[model samples]
Target: MTLRIGVIGTGAIGRDHIRRITNDLTGGEIVAVTDVNAESAKNVVSELHLNAKIYENGHDVIKADDVDAIIVTSWGPTHEEFVLASIAAGKPVFCEKPLATTAEGCKRIVDAEVAHGKQLVQVGFMRRFDKSYRQLKKIFDEGKVGEALVVHCAHRNPTAPGFSGDMAITDSFVHEIDVLRWLLDDDYVSCQVILPRNTRFAENGLQDPHMILLETKKGIRIDTEVFVNCKYGYDIQCQIVGETGIANLPEPQSVLMRSEAKLSTEIYVDWKDRFIDSYDVELQEWIDSTVKGEMNGPSAWDGYVVAVTSDACVEAKHSGGIVAIELPERPAFYDQGNNKVL
Candidate 1:
């Protein structure tokens, strides 16, 4: 059965998802879409030649009978509303990041989904689906490494033009907050943020480089440096230090070039080029799993956990002290990772 998907938000990421569902993937169809900028949404429909309806607002698309599932890619602030509505309507929703702006908000969504008595929401934590990360996890599972001792991670961008305040923590560093927990299969017990010298390239006094220290329940340490204005290229690095061996995330497949005098590997400048395949696999799995009435990806509980973790990180960023992360024990509802208990 084809999953008729209604996409909310026609921004760059939203537009890409629409294109992918309609043109690239099977088991899904873009039947409806809406955006804040109706003109831009219309332009996307025209350019893609999508056979989809342009609703006046996102809620209309969510309540449409033709849409079997909903995809929320709008501004972060509005995620809670649409996600809860989709839950109330008993439709599966695949939401992009943050899940909600606050931990309390994400908790609300979690309660609603739990009361609904089914898995109806999947948060967009794409790194868990990336091939390299998958391989890294397999190494851990297969005991190639004795035990993970420390994880070193770096998320770099060529430059961030409009970033300010704790956006780096909330917007940029949140991925690490989510994926690291999944990678380790442990919850963060404490967080501390170290603010280094601001990069000269930072716009409007934004803290360009932040060192976030996280300690898991199992005593494994994960340190991440989020440097957005590196002015070189988008680079994502992760290395697991284990008792016996080490595993590093393989960089994107780039040609080894022996240039004028040095051998170099290409680094992508745009994020889209970096994890495009992950996005494809993530959404395709979402489509396939949703069709079987199962949500096997990141759950709403994971979103709430990440929100709580990011909240603690931001608190550490402001207080310059180690902050405790207090998360409610995982309800049995989420005990099943890739399967529903019911």
Candidate 2:
């Protein structure tokens, strides 16, 4: 049976998901879509020439009985509402990162799913699907990287979005928080944000860069380098250091074919270049899982942990001090191989 998919928010990622479902690869078909920018939504529907229905709002799309699953790429604040509505409608939903803008918001979505007594929401943290990151995990799990000691994660973008600092913590670094927790299979106990010397490359009044230090429940430490304006390239890197060995994601190596006098490979200037395949793999899994009545990606628990940690990061950034991240005790529900962090 082909799963009927509904996509909300016709922005870049939203349109990309629609394209993925309609053209590239799919276990489902996009049956409906919505966006606050109705003009863009109409444009997408017309551009794709897909007969999918267009709705004025996400609520209408999710409530439509035909929607078997939902892909939520809307603004961060609206995620909680649509996700909870989908849960109420008993439809599986794939929400982009930060599940919600606040920890309280995330909790509401989590509680809704818990009340439903099943997993119905999958949060987007695409790093888990990246081949290089998965290879690093495999090597770490093989004990090639002995007793994991520390992990250094970096997320740098070539430019900053025209949003607030809250966005920096929520929409952006939230991915770092979630993926790090998943990689180490540990919960964060606290977080501290350190502001570096301001970079002239950033826009006026923009924070430009910061460092997030996180400590896990099991004492594994993680340092995340977050810079929105590196003036170099779009980059994501992680190095896992263990008592016995070290493993890290190698940069994209290319065959340097002789051309003009310049010996060069390729540098991704944007995320659409660097993580496009990862996004595709992530969405494909989501579609396949929706068809099978199962999910393998990050769970609501993962989203909750990230929300809790990101909240703490925001506080740390505001208070100019380290803040404790209090997480509920780990539930046995995630203890299965699905979350076996090395």
Instruction: Give the top-scoring candidate (TM-score).
Output: 1
Tens-digit lDDT track of model 2 for 170-213 = 76788778777667666777889898897887775767688889
Error of 1 at 220 (Å): 0.8
Indicate the residue-level lDDT of 329 in model 2.
Answer: 63
- Candidate 1, residues 230-339: lDDT per residue as tens digits? 99999999999999999998878889999999999989998877988898999999999999998999999989988999999999989999999998877888866572
In candidate 2, where is summed lDDT lowest over 10 consecutive residues? 333-342
RMSD for each of the candidates:
1.7, 1.9
Instruction: Name the top lDDT candidate.
Output: 1
Candidate 1 error regions (>4 Å): 339-342
Task: Point out where model 2 deviates above 4 Å.
Answer: 257-263, 331-337, 340-342
For residue 302, what is the lDDT in candidate 2? 81
User: Mind sharing the TM-score for model 1?
Assistant: 0.97
